[model samples]
Target: MAKNTTKNTEGQAPKGVRKPPATRKTAAQKKAEAEAKLKQQQLETGEGDNTPTDTPEQPNNEPTGETAEKEVTAGASESSAGQEGKTTETDKIKSDANPPVGNSTIEDLSDDEFDKGKRDGVSDDVEDQELMEGQMKLEDDGSTKIGDNPMLTDTKDKEEVQPFVRKTKIEKTSSNVSIKSLFKEWKKDQALRAKYRQEAEEAIKSGLPAPEFEDETTLRFDLAIQRNETWTDYQKSDLIHTVLYGYYLQPVLVEDSNDGKKWFIDGKQRLTTLMTFIEGQWALSKKTKPVYGYKIAGFKFNDLPSEMQDEIMDETITLVRIKNMTVAERDEMFVKQNSGTPLSKIELIRAMHSELSEQIDIELSSLKFFKEDLELTKKAKDKFIDVELILQIAMLIEEGKDRIKGLGADNYKEYVLRLKETEQIFSDEMIEKISNISNYLTLAFEDYEMDEVKKALKKVNVPIIFWTAITAMDDNLQPKLFGDFIRSFLISGYSVESAYGKSSQAGSSKKENVLIRLDEMSAALSQFIDMIRNASSIEEGVEQFNKHLADVNGVDREEGEDGERESA
Candidate 1:
């Protein structure tokens, strides 16, 4: 039952090709994936003879849909049996003894796209449609209707009919309406409502059974009235006015309203849905005061609960109006909205670079960055890790200049991200590429007598120190590169080596290269302010690091790398 352990030359992984950590799914997950694949195959073979009968022991189809239904039943039993025949763990181990390395497959080295609105990797069960479902409002009778927001556009079965395409986050497309699209959509909805209302009134007056009208309603409004915390009566009244306009202008929108071009800065779908329900008088249901009468989307002036309902209703239809601004304005607008949440200096700096006026924001973010480092170390959370900062500092020390060449900023962000994703994917040899960065940093800071490096290390708040150390190893980098860098970082203030392994400090986990990397990090950051100023992107800044590295390589080459650079 055992196969010989030999590497397949053809299956060899492409050089520098790192594999994603292959996660083994649970039985339920595997079953779902298998079923999905089978369904897809069935679709492809519906009218053809391509039904897979490669295994005589498996179900054979009759080429009829009825036959297919029966075959599907039979296939379940046969497939389960086939699954049982898969290689055992021991056998798998023997066969995989010489598996392929990510040693031919090419991957596009695209920048990581940040999805800011939601947390990363929300469960698949949490569909975008869920947001729409909550987009409900009471019909005059207190029933629920689905929210009509463009974000929920794909939720309807009809929208799914077309073959789908997955687009990258940064991909440029005409219809990827920026937050600016809110006003335009609102105006469109308003016009549509007015036209329908006029036709209905005419039909009613003409003694017709029913007037032509759109069956559903959507959430769309261009006003910044919805915030999670509290909604004022004035804001509520403003919202009512917007909805009232929709009802009055039923068949003819006053196109002259100057506020009709705004988009969502916040509460995007929620605001729009509230107004839509009110305008269309759709059925909306909730826990209490569940029905906001579809007769008109008015809030009861005397009732507190009614006021709350109005707030919810307003939220479902509110949007922030946008102006025709350059890309810089948009970036600033984004940053301002995110300001409520604590952000790293690197993140702020990256945004600031797009605007000459906002360049000073980097200092504020830097202070935030320092605080984040402290917090990350205390909590050992990944978010607190200052990966970009460490890389910026490290590359500067090693390259002598402010930037890395080729891929740009010394591949700082890329390196950090890869380490995070494939912490276990790359081999020890491969890991050295990053580990050396840590060592070089340590040696670079050793020459400086500052307490700041020690403080940063002692605080042990950020994950950056650990990664910097990990990357400073050979993966051929020595301790010298970052030791001076670390020292310099602190000379502007902190010392780290004073309590090398002292038990009294906040972070006492002193692995051999840990302190060394911390020092390197300190040194890199201290001396690399200029590198930061020159950085256009995370990669570009690392190029400045190449200049720092040139000096480091020269020193290490001449003095010969000390035994201090050896792996623990």
Candidate 2:
């Protein structure tokens, strides 16, 4: 069962070309050289038949349609081995890999049309039609419909079509006249409801749906109104008025199974609004609206007549039941649906198909410093800014400035997108490095019992300087410098300029600004270290540091000399 390890180079060269006597390489080296030659040939000819064994295996993260296309272009720049006339290693790998059918091949695409195909080696199991399933179909009147086309047919005892494409669009029908009888409340059995909740929570944690829950309701806004903490009074009022005016609510997407269980995919806002009104959680706004059946605009559900209440209940909301889509695909639909709506970066990250952001967030949250010690406003959890800062720092350490050239809060939306596309960001080694940074920070900060140090560290720009400084120092010596470095750095004029100057405030997130700030802080710390090394006493060191600060900040000490910069 032993495989052949020898290279068969007998007739590889073209006719009339005299072969040079081969070097006395070992079998492994010979095999490797042969592969290199084969790869070169494939790249030159755009022939992907030759298999290159040296290429590293791509990670298992599957990109959606749009991102897959991005991979093709990104893949080109990713390959360092490309030559003047040769196709990129990404092209070679993609040619050999099982690309999703119907996707444009590497050879057909120009450099501009490249998909970072290198990262998309894992073939998507979800079929092409399944991907196109929930795509919004526009009607003549301008309403968006989900599941407008019947992707699958239920005709029994008939020949199944090879490639089914629904030719007929699902037509819109008038709303039911009898309000109370047309629609029923989305009620699930007790066991199914519990199961749905568990799955919904898991989806909220990570976009990947639970095994059994994808087919059933993931989130029921009617039953789960208490859980949505972000729904505002103004938003609820708008929804109530919207319903009272008899405007058609957007179709709520659901995954309906043969067993008749329904799982919600989108339209939670509209659904929650309707239910909140019916339950009398909030009355209609003072804005005049009695158009449906009500006499007064500000009537609660109970204050309305029985027929009016029945009319609201019987009002039909459109339902788009999905089938044949993967859990990732399902999550993608929700993300796309909420694309225009205002949402936190972390919330959007959770709805994404990748697990990297959520995984990193979970990891950061587990740290005691992140939970209790670090000063976080209540908005931190909702806005997820804490995790966002952690991720930015993690990337700063991981990618270095060459890759993250434009890193800052200004381009954070773009930065995170690229981070998701990048496979190396979430490696076990990288995650451990982040953990080490966190541990270093916790130990270095917590060791000092001074409340002043803790309060100073809570400021926004301080951690960036502290973290950058600690990371720049010798690992063993980082803890030693923490207290002195923090106090000294805070007492510098540059810290105040860096933290509060108009230039710093306006350009705080600019790439050049971030680099300059870090560089100057490092320069200041380097001086402090030099003072520590040569000065005879702590008093002498402080005096030297105070004098050195003016020079570091490029301010003239000849005109004025101060004792020390004020601590934050």
TM-scores for all predictions: 0.22, 0.48
Let me know the TM-score candidate 2 reaches against the reference structure.
0.48
Most accurate candidate by TM-score: 2
Segments of candidate 2 deviating more than 4 angstroms? 1-232, 255-264, 271-319, 339-353, 365-374, 378-380, 409-425, 443-463, 466-484, 487-503, 529-568
The number of the candidate with the highest lDDT is 2
Residue-level lDDT of model 2, residues 1-568, one tens digit each, is: 9997655576665455667787775544544554465445434653223325675443433333344355454555555456355555545454454243345543343332232221232223233323244654344465644442454645435786799787533332223223232223333333577778887788878977655544354344322111134666567666656665777667777655445554566766666666557666787667645565545557788887776566677677667777776545655766777777755555665455245554655576567656655656666554655666666676666556665554455455565666655633466776676667667666667754445444445435543653465544563445545555654555343334443333356656666766665666666667777786688976687568866665555544444334233333
Candidate 1: minimum summed lDDT over ten consecutive residues — where? 104-113
- Model 1: per-residue Cα lDDT at residue 265: 38
